[model samples]
Target: MNEHYNRWLHHRGLDPDLMQELLLLSQDEIEDCFYRHLDFGTAGMRGLLGPGINRMNLYTVRRVTEGLARTLIAQGDDTRKRGVAIAYDSRRFSPEFGAEAAGTLASHSVRVYLYPSLRPTPMLSYAVRHLGAAAGIMITASHNPASYNGYKVYGSDGAQMPPHRVDKILQALAGIDELALPSHSLQDGIASGWIKEIGSEVDTAYYNHVLSLSHENNATANQQLKVIFTPLHGTGNRPVRHILGELGFTQVHTVSAQETPDPDFPTVSAPNPEEHDVFTLALTEAEQYTADIVIGTDPDADRLGLYARNPAGNYTAFNGNQIGALLLHYTLERKAAKGELSSQGIVLKSIVTSEMGRSIASSFGVKMEDTLTGFKYIAEKVDRYEALNTPFLFGYEESYGYLLGSFVRDKDAIQAAMMCCEMAAYYKQAQNLTLTEVLEILYQQHGAYIESIFSFTFQGKKGLEKMSTLMDTLRNQPLKQIADLPIAQVKDYRLGIDHLPKANVLKYLCTDNSWVAIRPSGTEPKIKFYISAVADIIDAAQEKKKRMEKDLRDRLETSL
Candidate 1:
């Protein structure tokens, strides 16, 4: 075994002070932990918190931050002078990780604006742009379980750092052979003004921006609109409720048990808004209040989930695609009705997202653009449109993430929450319809667009190799048919020759308007298969989706 791996194993066997604190770990765990350093991908570093090179310990955090500091210094005096903003979520070691990052930056004489308490990911993005910081760091694992944590970096534009800059950050990280930082204290940095504490002022500013998005003039006008909201035990509680109250959502009900931040996320297994089971608490409350709508944001509050009453009176969670289409249609339709629709307006969605958004945008004479799978790509598109003097009307991904008005470069669940409420209220007034009804109307007008995502986990080194091999195999041998339907073309994003920038992905377009995409997860050790199909009627779409899913399963079984 390598020296580092042996050290990890020795540490595991000793039952020493540090080892005990990290909980029970086996030899295999030690090997996996020390095998390699956590990767710094397009999003940044993420891994389980433990005492290994591959783990998210203080040493790894410092090394990454030192590298970031070096990159900032290389940019020149102005960039270093502007510094970086830092925030943490309510997770184990999150605050410590934030402090370590700040101290590393301070060692290089870079200013840091660290949040006084836990803050959402979107707020960190906002603070970066609001403070004119050179970059930003948010210590969070998002909706992951308690065993995981992560680091997300943002650029000056407040979007997740783009691939080009992230590559530079990785290069700088490699330049530092040692993980230790020079003698420096985060407290001392704060005392010397190199680090500043951000608090309610920024929160108040962000809440004000959310309130400005409200189209409801009379708070009492929508008082009858009963709403239930849950933060899923993350950082969205304060802002989501504050904005709802400010917008005069009188009957806004909170999932009382889940309103507080808990690092353990005791209520749910994953704390993800995309999961139907995570709404257990909110659904229970919704039942009591007879709520018109149920909304949930994940741990970091960048993604939003919606649930509405069906004609049968049972609440059903709307998938990300359904919500995205509704929001796009509503935003444009309202703009047109108010005579605010501009010729320069545009909508952006990830390439993997539902194409129903395109139909909605086209109905209003707005241009729709597709990017790679990350919100950063969507933000980049927004930046491009802004430079061209065009307007950004809306943007979204298939993972329950949405953005409106571009005030915040990343996904803003707070904005999505408010807009969804407004859309629900508008439908209520205009057609006496609920969100579910709005979706039915959309299905009737446009072809029904159905999408499903399947994830296969491949853990450890061997699993990683297997995942790469699988991607290569798919690239080398493309699928000609799925469920007897002919595939028209294949899109290989990894080859860097696509409609958008290159990524490590393959998309197969089928003759029957069905498609399947394969890509590695940016934040986890897994691969995701996204299947989408569109048809003139809901029954046809449902039937096609069934066949496609069965074929995909059979193929994966045989190929893997």
Candidate 2:
């Protein structure tokens, strides 16, 4: 069977290097590599960057773009003419992939706006709307390991292209039965005026908008604040530093080792900001500089990592929920204090995010809404509110993704970093408190709510099957109790309630103020358990969370 696939791929014109490797792989390795096409869902295609149909290589990139091309063509001449915008991160072959996509679109007579160099994901979202294009493509695997790459699609609205639209693109992808298709050369496309490179103009606009999000225009506070930032060797170096420096953040320091655009991400085990260890170097710099705050963005610059000084003068790290709650509280308090907060103000969060921010919003009389676990859903709500002429104050997910302004339809870490700086300044200068102190204040006001996510990764084809079976068992035969806590409610998102799209997710609410949610990750091969616990005291909340996690994990292990 492996030999059959090897011959088939060689005949289909796969790259010679990849074909050579296919012939050398062990039988089991070949089976794993050729067992299936990398599944392209709402997150687009993401996988290891290597040979085989299951990987993210030139062939798969072109194949996905070809699908997008056919989808756009079917939408009529106007849509095709509006064309697609392409941007890539600082990953291996990212530039080449962007060019391949642009060339593929250009082959179909579609216009293309290609970024000259690596840029962040949110900028691609901004470019889609800024360029008036019908679609956008970002070549990034977000904060995944250096070995992975991805292709993310966006609609004209700047969000990840919604599900209904993705279905059409998938249909187009299914129709392409062969990889050896004639295509236009990148140079020819550029010469023909169909492929355009965009830079500085969009960067300027993005920087200007990010700067404008600093409502607390206390130049003295900003100048006085000490900050340390790292881009984790991805695409955020230039823009993040430029925006901060231009905004009067005079005392800024960066981790020199991780400042350059190196796809290998030599400094960290993973480029993801969510992991505690990714901040090792940044934390070192923070201590050396005695910085008031530390910030790091993932490879694509859409997700942000934050650390701040506590009352004890010790730097403390915050999880995504804590960051979101802080930003939400800061934005609301400042807006309401200045009487700038609208009467129709609303805040959005993913279903899996902590509910602490929800309580904070209520205290400020702002509506708090929950979408499924994706920034795109949050953006969808933002778009609806924009159409309704209502106010969108904030949107965030627990995965370090956040959006503060409507200027960009996806999570903007640049915006988050700016606001976090300003918020830290506000609490320090005006309120005489640190971020940790402000968080304590919020906790006091709304009871202590703690949230954590545990992920179990299963590799290879059998691992995928194991994950699927786990979700199936949970959904088909629901849990009646966990840790002797009675179930208060069960929300099966697959049924699609509360005006949200259907998804394969299960949430079990306990009688106590705690809950557990189970779902497969959209972009990776892992089953994530979202657990949240609340109590009148911080220690009690932490204890409850630990207990819930232990009981549930133990039960899951026994069942397996």
Best candidate according to TM-score: 2
The per-prediction CA RMSD against the true structure, in angstroms, equals 2.1, 1.4
Error of 1 at 526 (Å): 1.3
Pairs of residues clashing in candidate 2: none
Per-residue lDDT for 1-560 in model 1, tens only?
A: 55665554455243254466444657677678878888876567888888778888777788888888999999999999999999999888899889989988887789999998888888899999889999999998887788999999999999998888888988987746433345367888987779988877888888777777665545544777889999988999988887777777888988988888998999899889999999988888898889999999998899999999777789977999999999989888877887888968889999899999898888788899899988999999898899998989999999888998677899989899989888887778667898898898899998899889998899998899999999999988899988878999998987776567779989999987789989999888999999898899888888888888899898888878
lDDT, candidate 2, equals 0.88
Error of 1 at 23 (Å): 9.7
lDDT of each: 0.86, 0.88
lDDT tens per residue, model 2, 389-409: 998899999999999989899
* Runs off by more than 4 Å, candidate 2: 2-4, 7-9
